[model samples]
Target: MLWFLTCVAALIGGYFLYGAFIEKVFGIKVDRQTPAHTKTDGVDYVPMSTPKVYLVQLLNIAGVGPIFGPIMGALYGPAAMLWIVLGCVFAGAVHDYFSGMLSVRNGGASVPSITGKYLGNGAKHFMNVFAIVLLLLVGVVFVSAPASMLTNLMNDQFNLGITMTAMVVIIFAYYIIATIVPVDKIIGRFYPLFGGLLIFMSVGLISAIAISSDHSVLGGYEPSQMFTNMNPNDLPLWPALFITIACGAISGFHATQSPLMARCMENEKNGRFVFYGAMIGEGIIALIWCAIALSFFDGMEALQAAVANGGPGNVVYSSAFGLLGTFGGIIAFLGVVILPITSGDTAFRSSRLILAEYFNMEQKTLRNRLLMALPLFVIGGILTQVDFGIIWRYFGFANQTTAVMMLWTATAYLVRHNKLHWITTVPAVFMTSVCITFILNNSQLGFGLPMTLSTITGVVSAVAIAALVIIKSRNSGEVDSEEESLQS
Candidate 1:
């Protein structure tokens, strides 16, 4: 309980302390016009209220990553807590804030476009393909995850008497429709309702924990029970824990989603509150799930056995069921079902915007929107039938890998402008190390090298990248100066 409270407090307080510091570093200017005001196409670029935009941003970034990821992360015991609280505050929030602010500065551009502008043309082309694929992957995964849960809950029949297959098709159609429609129409209005349920569910679980002795925090591990690598697969804690808890900490996916709100933000000053603030909010929710999964199941051994038996979704359902009775079960169903559906909606929406930008298609007309969207929905449906486990495994890799690219891009932007480049440089190196080591060491992903060998390779790669950042930092300022001279 002590550990949980302290971490929660730290993440919340960091929003004010560190969030403000990063805002100052980024230099928010109010007099400048935002893309929402400048490019009011009324299709993608639309000005939304600060509160509405913030909630949509929060829901867009979170999804099931915080819930399911932390349950799996808890197999490593309290070590996951350290990553959630600290990684979120220092690495994740910083990554999200700059990515969003940079997007706003660049005319509400998608992340890939922003990367290309700062990093180079080569990086831009890579981002074009990479961002689309990642967004589609996110969309498909969210659809299948929630569809399965809905099937189980409906017992193969719903209030509308539709089968699971029908449910999936209906849900997939919603994704397409949501993508084609205006942002203010679907995403802006209902995301707050979905977001409310998400937060309300977390709070209910927390209250249940406070009132029950059986759900004591840290009860699953004592001082000696802590930090000995509790994973049954013997996966090394270094990279696995970091990747396992990606969304709750820092995610490259957040950068992709940031542009959506970046297009709608009323003021540059709101970036910290919306982008950095949303990431911190996710960290708190993840900390709750991690602590609950750790302590709520009696001990680490019990939690592991349960997870192995039924999977992470089982843990979510069972926890909610145990805590709040019938209402808890309903909340659990929503957590597993509705929340991810909303996330899938935005994921596809991001894909539409990215593709339209990539191909230079105008989205002002419904005809253009449908022309692009039909193929995406078809591909998403085909993907749903493929092995989702395969998609999810690659997603974790693509996700962190995307973060590495964004961080490096941010690092370059800061250096060219002669700001604090270290803000992103340090975290970029760390995540680069994690992604490299995971591929080299994890049996499913990499060559299955020995841990020591993989660690050495990872460290070497990080150092090499650091050296490149320094070199780029030196050249960036000169390039900027020349460009300024030319413009002057």
Candidate 2:
């Protein structure tokens, strides 16, 4: 409980302190015209209130990743708390802030374009394909996971006899409408309510923990526990914990989602509150879920068995229903359901935007919007038919790899301007190591090297890349004319 409170405090402090420094570093132009005004098309680029943009961005980057990922990461003990707090403050929020701000600075370009601008044309071409694939997989995963949950919830709770296939069709239909419609129409209007539910769920669960009579079960942090390998499977903490806790800690996927809100932001001044603040909000959710998971099952042994038996979904449902009571639990359950659905809609919407930008297609016409969106859905719909279990394993790596690219890109941006570059460069190198070690150590993913060798290679490779980026940035000329104009 002491550790949990401290982590929560640190996340909030991070927003005010470190987040402000990032905003200053980016040099927010208060009077500058944002893309929302310059590129307003009443569809993707409409200006929105800061509150709405913040909530939408919150729901966008956050899916089930915060909840499920932390629940899984909790298997590692207090070390999970360490990652969530430090990683969110230093790595995740900074990454998110830059991703959105850079997009805002570049007429709401997608990750591929942003990376391409900094990393080069080759990177641009690669990220175009890489980002689209990641978004599609996210779209499909969100669709299937939520559809199945709704199907079971309706069946078991209300006996509505809703089939998963029917639910999938319903979700996909919503995704299409959400994808093709104007920003202010469906997503802009409804996402705040969904975001409210998410907050309500988090607050209610935390209140439950606070009021519980038994404090011992909630467990305070211990120094010795930090080094203890509490994972039931004896998984190493270095790479496995980092990958498992991506969303709550630092995820590359957030970079893909940032541009959506980047287009809607009315002012550069609100960047910190919207982008970095949203990541902090997500870190809070992740912390609550982790704490609850650590204490909910009586012991780590039972928690592991339960997770193995029914997966994180079962654990979430059971915990919410048990702690929140019938009425509160129902609302909380709906919140969980909303997480993926909201993210799924935005995932598809982002895909459309990225594709439109990639092809230089005009999205002003409803016909153009449909043309870009229809194919993505068709591909996504077909992908829903593949073995999801197989595809999901690759997503973690792809997600982090994209993050690495964005971090390096942000580093390059700073270096080109002759400002602080280490802020991004350090995390960039760290996550590069995490991704490399993960793939190398996992048998199905890489060469199945031993953990020590994988760690060594991962660290060495990341350092080498960092050195090259620093040297190249020193040799690199100036910020592009377009970028200078945007910043000015």
Candidate 3:
């Protein structure tokens, strides 16, 4: 209980303390004109109030990642909690703030463009394909998961006889509409409502846990089991836990989502509140779910059995219905549905922007938006036909790998300015190690190398990359001159 409360407080405190420090390091300009005003395309680059942007940004990144990822991570015991709190504060929020602000600095450029600007053209080329495919995977994964859930709920409750296929089509159609419309049209207006449902559901769950008669509701903090790797499958704790809990801790996927809001933000000052604050909000949701999962089913053994039976979705359903009752269950169900749909839409939208930026095509006209969006949706629609279970497994690693790249990009940005580069440098190297080690050790992804060899190789590779980046930054040019010029 003490550990749980401390984690919660740390996340909140981290925001005011560390979040402010990051803002100072990035050097926010209150009077600077944002892309929303300078670019003003009416389609994507539209100025929005701080509150609306924050809510939209929150929902955009808050998909099932936090809820589902943390639940899965809970299988690894309280070590998951430590990762979530620390990772969100130090790694995730910083990555998000810089990704968004960098885009703002570069006229709301996509992640690939921003990466290319700092990391060079090779990275830009790689991220072009890498980011789009990742977005497509995110779109498809969110589509299938929610379609299945909505199908079950509707068929069970209203006997609507809605098949998953039909739901997929309906969702795809909505995604198309959401992808092409102006920022203020559907997403901007309705997302606050969706965000409301999400917050309501989270609050209800927290209340249920608080008032429960069971003394074990927050009982995962037993010092004996706090740091233990309690996975039923005996999975190694290092890379797997990090990958499994990406969003609650840190996710590269948020890098893709941040630019959408970056283009919409009216001021640089709001970047911390929207980007860092939203990630913290996600951490809170993840913390709640992880704590509940630890004690909801009597013990770690029972939690394992429940998860094994039906995955995290089952756990989400059981907890909502079991604790919050029928009405709250329905709301929780809608929140679940809203989470992925919101993200999937933005996934497609972000892809459209990426393609537009790649080709130097203007998107002011409907035809241009359609031209960019149609092919991507066609490919996405086709992918819906294939089973994603195997492909989705790679997303965890891919997502973190993207984060590693973004972190390195931010590290380079700080290094170029001759500021304290360690803020992003440490996390960048750490995540680089996690990604390299995970792929090598996991049979499904890489060579299935021995764990010891993989760990040693990952650490060595990360250190080599860090040293290389530092040397390159020193030789690149007069960073001090560039910094002064930018300030002027």
TM-score of candidate 2 against the unseen true structure: 0.97
Candidate 3 lDDT score relative to the true structure: 0.88
Q: How would you encode candidate 3's per-residue C-alpha lDDT over 1-488 as one tens digit per residue?
A: 67778899999999999999999988988888888988888889899999999999989998888888989999888879999999999999999999999888888889998888778889999999899988998898889888878887888767999998999999999999999989899999999999889988888887787787763555645688887898878877888899999989999999999999999999999999999999999999899889878867777788888888877877888888777788888898788779889999999999999999899888999999999999999998888888766656877888898999999988888888777889999999999999999889999878899999999999999999999887786576434332221112
List ranges where model 3 is wrong by over 4 Å.
478-488
* Ten contiguous residues minimizing lDDT sum, candidate 2: 479-488
Better candidate number, 1 or 2, judged by TM-score: 2
- Model 1 spans with C-alpha error above 4 angstroms: 156-162, 478-488
TM-score per model over all chains: 0.95, 0.97, 0.96
Pairs in clash, predicted candidate 2: none
Better of 1 and 3 by lDDT: 3
Query: What C-alpha lDDT values do all the predictions have?
Result: 0.84, 0.88, 0.88
Per-residue error for 393 in candidate 3, Å, reads 0.9
User: Candidate 1: how many backbone clashes?
Assistant: 0
Clashes of each: 0, 0, 0
